[model samples]
Target: MPASAPEAPAPALPRPLIGWRLLALFYDLWPALALWMLASLCFTLGYTIAGHHDPHENIAPLSVLQWALWATCWLLAGLYAVISWRRGGQTLGMRPWRLRVVGADGRPPSWQALCARYAVGTLSLLAAGLGFWWAWIDRDRLAWHDRASGTRMVRNPKP
Candidate 1:
C-alpha cells in the first residue's frame, strides 16, 4: 500500500490573559462613552422639544426623564457590544488588542448568550469589577460573564 501524508493538527486556541482583557475593556470604553453621549444628546433634544423653553433648564437629576436617558444609554451600549460580538466577534476596541469573543464551541455565540454576557459584564462593572477579578482565581481563567454565557475572549495570533 502507498504511504499517505499525515493529517495536520488543529490550531491551538489563543486564550487571552486577564491583563489583555482589561486593556481591551478600557479601550472599548471610548466607544461606549460616545454612544452614551449620543443618547444623552437625543434625550436633551427631546426635552427641549417638549416645551422646556428655558435656556438654562436641563433634565433634572433623578427625574424620570433622566432615568430614561440613563436606560437608553445603557441599551445603546449593549446594542453596540452585542451587535459587534454577533457580527464579527470583535469590537473596535478589541480590534487593536486582537481580542475576539468566541463561543465555548469556538463559534459565534447565539444572541441570547451575547445578551447574557453583556448583562453580566454590566453587573461585574457595577460590582467594582469583582467579576473580572474572578478570572485570576478561576481555574480556566474565565470571567463570570464568560462562564455564565459560555463565551470566551481569545487573542488572535499576530499576522
Candidate 2:
C-alpha cells in the first residue's frame, strides 16, 4: 500500500465584525460591573472604618479616593481580560460570540500586548467608541486596541 500524504492544516478564521465585538463587550460588562461594585464596597467600608473623616470636606477634581477606586477597577478588569486571552484567547463574553484575540503572529498575545490592549481599549471607549467605529473605514477591520496592541479579534469556527 502507498503511504498517505500529510494532512493539510486548517485555514484561519475570519475577523469578527464590529457589531459582534460590541455585543461581546456588552456581555463582558456585567462581570466588570460586579467587580466594580465589590471594589466600591471595600473602599467605602475602609473609609468609614478609618473614621474621623471631615464631614464638610468637598471632593476635589483630583480626589485620591476616586483615583484609587478607578485604579482598582482598571487592575481587576485588566487581569480578567489579559489572563483570559492568554489562557484560551476567548473571554467569557467573547466565547458566546465565537471571538478570539490573537497577536500579529497569530498566536496568544504577550503580557505587554495585553496590557496595551486594556489601556488603549479604555481610551477607545472614552473617545465615544471612535476606535470601534474606525473599523468601518479600516482596510483590515481592526479597532484601536487591536491596532495599538498588535492584536486582532477573529471569529472561531464551530466544531
Candidate 3:
C-alpha cells in the first residue's frame, strides 16, 4: 500500500473590525506627546544655559533644533513600534487594545515594512491625518500605512 500523506490544518480567517487598533493609537499617542514635551523643555533649558540674550530672539535656531528633536522622537517611536511589533506582535498601544500588526500571511511585519509603515504614517499625518481617517472608509479598515506596507492591524486573539 502507498503511504498516506498528512493533511494540513485549516488556516484561520482574518480578523474583523474591533476598534482595538484605534484604541492602541490613542495609547501610543500619550507617550509620544510626553516625549515631545520633554524634548521641548530640554531645548528651552539648553538655550537658556547658552546665555542667549533673548531666547525668543533665536527663533531660527530654536525652530531647527525643535524639528530635529521631533524627528528623533519619531525615529524612537518607530523603533519602539518595530521592535514590539516584531517580537510580541504588538506595540505598547496595541497590547493594551488587543491589536497587532501582521502581514497578509499572518506573520509579524519585517523591519523594512515597519519603517515603511511609519514613513507613510508620518506623511499621512503631515497631510492632516487623512491617512488615519482612511481606516473609517477603507474596505479592509486599513490605514494608509497599512495599505502601503501590505500589513493589517487586526484584533489579536486572546491568549
Candidate 4:
C-alpha cells in the first residue's frame, strides 16, 4: 500500500499576553512624547515669529494655537492607529512588539470599530489612563479600547 499523506496541523489561536502589550505600550509612548515635544517647539517658534516682546505676553493666542496643534496631533495618531489596526492588526508600535489587533471573530475591524477603539483610547488617557491598565487585570488581556471595539491585541502569528 502507498504511504498515507500527513495530516495538516491545526491553526494556532491568537493569544493576548501581557509581555506583548507592555512592549507595544513602550513602543507607542516614545512617538507620542516626540509629537508632544515637536508641538511645543512649533508653538514657541510661532510665538517668536509673531513679534511678541515676551512669548508669554500673547497668552490667549498661544493658548488657542497650542490647543489646536494638540488636537491635530491626536487626530493624526488616531488615524494612524485605525488604519494600521485594520490593515494588518499592527501599528508601528505593535509591529515591533509582534502584536496585532483583530476583531472578536479573528477578522479585520470595521470603520466603526476603529472609531470606538480610538475614542476609548483618548478617554483612557484623559481619565488617568485606567483603561490602558485594564489589560493588566482583564482575563483576556484586552485594553478598554479593545473591549469597547470588540477587538483584541494578540501576538502576531506570522513573521
TM-score per candidate, in order?
0.92, 0.88, 0.77, 0.73
Q: Per-residue lDDT for 1-159 in model 2, tens only?
A: 999999998887798889999999999998888989899778776776677354444334477998999899989988888998899998899999999999988888998998899899999999999999999889999999999999989998887
Q: Can you write out model 4's per-residue Cα lDDT over 1-159, one digit (the tens) per residue?
A: 999999997675666576676678678877767766776777777778877547665446557776887787787677777887777778778876678777888788898998899899889878887887877888877788888989877676665
Rank the models by TM-score, top first: 1, 2, 3, 4
Q: In model 1, what lDDT does residue 85 have? A: 98
RMSD in angstroms between candidate 3 and the native structure over all alpha carbons:
3.3
Give candidate 4's error at residue 100 in angstroms: 0.4
- Badly placed stretches (over 4 Å) of model 1 are 1-8
lDDT by residue for model 3 (6-40), tens: 99975664554536555677798887777767867
Model 3: which residue pairs collide? none
Considering lDDT, which of the candidate structures 2 and 3 is the better prediction for this target? 2
Candidate of highest TM-score: 1
Rank candidates by lDDT, best first. Answer: 1, 2, 4, 3
Q: After superposition, how far is residue 107 of candidate 4 from its true place, in Å?
A: 1.0
Please give, for residues 1-34, the per-residue lDDT of candidate 1 as tens digits: 9999998987967778889889889988999999
Steric clash pairs (candidate 4): none
lDDT of 4: 0.77
